[model samples]
Target: MVHTFSGNPLDREDAGRRDDVWIDTARDDDSTRFLALADLNVPIEGESLHWLHREHFDESDLESALLLGSEEGAARFVVDLSNESASADRYVDARSAATFLSMEDAGVVAHARSLVDWHRRNRFCGRCASPLIPKRGGNVLQCGQCEANLFPRTDPVAIMVIVDGDRCLLGQSSGRMARSNFYSALAGFIDQGESIEEAVRREVMEEGGVRVGDVRYHSSQPWPFPSSLMIGCHGLAETTEISIDEKEMNDVRWFSREEVLAALAEESDVLRIPGRMAIAHHLIHDWATGTIEV
Candidate 1:
């Protein structure tokens, strides 16, 4: 299955990056659909997520807008709201919006969230401390003094299902909130100069004292909570002695296949994995159902 934000709904035309006139024209076009965000809060209406039409909202209410590209002859653009008090438009974070919106809309909204969030954080250049200006339709930021270019960033995370025979290892991160006996897959950010497979092996050993061998790539998901690319994989555990790092996880344990099945079926008294909204859920489910090669 295509993960929530893995599939994009718009065609991010690369060739149009140099067309300043086209970008400006598309932003003001009547067929343009705008997604306005403020402090990472997205606009919503009733049960549906709607985008602002170009002619509806005042131009003054927009802070920084980007050309998102066309679909079926209609242009889609994402904009940052000038202020919180500008309009009474209902707003919610990406998590809440994902629950009610379709996968395509969720993906589009996530893209918008990452873009607006990048612009909000990268207001100045690190080289010369000069204010960065939006270029290439907010896809790139340029420094006036140094002429340095900045692009949106995405952190890559290795989220894996470590299987040891009939059971799989799962843990709750030390930073995660209390989840009433819930344990998801172990994940860590990919380190510099390390391949994703190497990062997975290293993290498993560092966290739980387990040796991972034979890693298999499964799927990837775009986790838009501040922009993350989740690389989901399955790993066979060569040794499974439980010696967990307290600083890495609040709890770490092994659950049997039957236990995982019960949890996925919502009939477990011990384990409660993440819901379908997360890639971890899919990873766990695939392992539990014998779909993933161990």
Candidate 2:
């Protein structure tokens, strides 16, 4: 099972409900289609949703619709169904119920938030100061003057669950352990001109000072805090000498399968890991349950 952070209990029936509803940019005459800022369920009233763009709604019929940018400067589109408006109680606001929705819903919200933010920030061209226009149903931006086309970016990052038989590798960020026991697999950004495999090898070697071989891809998730795509993997540890980068991690060690099970069952006090909302949890869980074949 994939561990997802936000949107755990989303009502599947409510998501993408108004595929036929017309969404459009806010018009001067459209008094009801104003924007509101999303803030963890508490919306800021009278806030104008920036980065107005159009999207095609095709349920029973095809229609054009307007998508709104969230207050956090993330792109999100809501269908305007005032003509056939459903109960306000029916729609689950992303702000309030992010933590309660399913992993899929969380992923959708994260994508929307990040894309909207990208649209807002890249309003002007980098080459010359000129206005940019939306393209590809808000998936890309094109400059009017310089003609620079910018696509939606998903930053690639590598996170691996290194295993040595019954024990798994885990690390903690320095200074944050006191606030909460945050333990996760070795992770780092994929550098330019490097393959994913190369990045994985380089990151594990640099962070944990361990040599990994037979690296295998596990799974991936969209982490849209600011647009990151986390690539999860499993690696075989050839050597296990803990030499952590003091700037990146405080400590790195191997946790036995039993120890991880204890943590999952809330039976261990010495170590605590991320909740089921994180990919790290899935990576560890897969190993603990004998699902990770490596």
Candidate 3:
């Protein structure tokens, strides 16, 4: 199941190092290797930043390079001189790159991108009005004043595929692209003091106006668009009637397994389900394949 999606597994041996690692974005040295995310259709160049593993290369083995960030608050990742043979001139967005890279490679890149984005956004200390510095090999942020340490945060979100018998509940968000009738599971952020089960029930009720029972955790994924951990679940539908919150969703409906498979295979730009890169797609696929029983 994990291997079905992109950015699932990463070789963490090098990233597990406890030393403060550097990401070089400069072009002068030719010894470093760079993975071009833009080639895969990610909209921004180096917009996502998070480190997965660190490799110990001698300072002399690699040349010092500058990290470049976008004017709109993008961080500069490591520069690779070894990628000189590759076309560095081309810039592919991260979204497209996720499709291009092998699932393992995409996962690594997503981790690094998420970490870097965290560092950039959390530049100031929350406890004190002091500037924070990177520590713990870029994993921890320390405030110069008061000596406070901060860690990266992954927001927990609950996403569920609600099932009754031969049908599952799906909703279309109001913010969806034009001409899109595609729907997946209902999802929402988990509020504080709410258990995952509670979240599943609450989100289902709030978004689709349906009561859910027997909520069970199915799988989880690190969604690093801006640091989110998607908690996937399967919820037994206690009520089939759906009353969607018009402000949040455009429409809600129940889909049969056959209908879902059709949507999954649908290639039209208009009638498409979530991409395979997303856990939503996995949840649907799993349900369709009987891997996740309601």
Q: Please, what is the whole-model Cα lDDT of each candidate in the order they appear? A: 0.84, 0.62, 0.65
Q: List clash counts for every candidate, in order.
A: 0, 17, 33
Candidates in descending TM-score order:
1, 3, 2
Encode model 3's per-residue lDDT on 68-172: one tens digit a residue: 221122232332333233334445545566666667656655665566567668878898889997654356788999889987788999999998998888888
RMSD of 2: 8.7
Superposition-based RMSD of candidate 3 using all C-alpha atoms, in angstroms? 7.7
Tell me the spans in candidate 1 whose CA falls farther than 4 Å from its real position. 60-63, 86-89
Off by over 4 Å in 3: 3-87, 267-271
Best-fitting candidate, measured by lDDT? 1
TM-scores of all predicted structures:
0.95, 0.72, 0.75
lDDT of candidate 2 at residue 281, scale 0 to 100: 81
lDDT of 2 by residue, 1-294 (tens): 454533323222222223323223222222323222232121222231222222222342112222433233233443333244232323444443355654545545565556555655677888887988765445557798888988778799999989888898898877657336567888889999988888888998888898888888888877766678888888898998878887877888889899999898878887788776678888888888898687
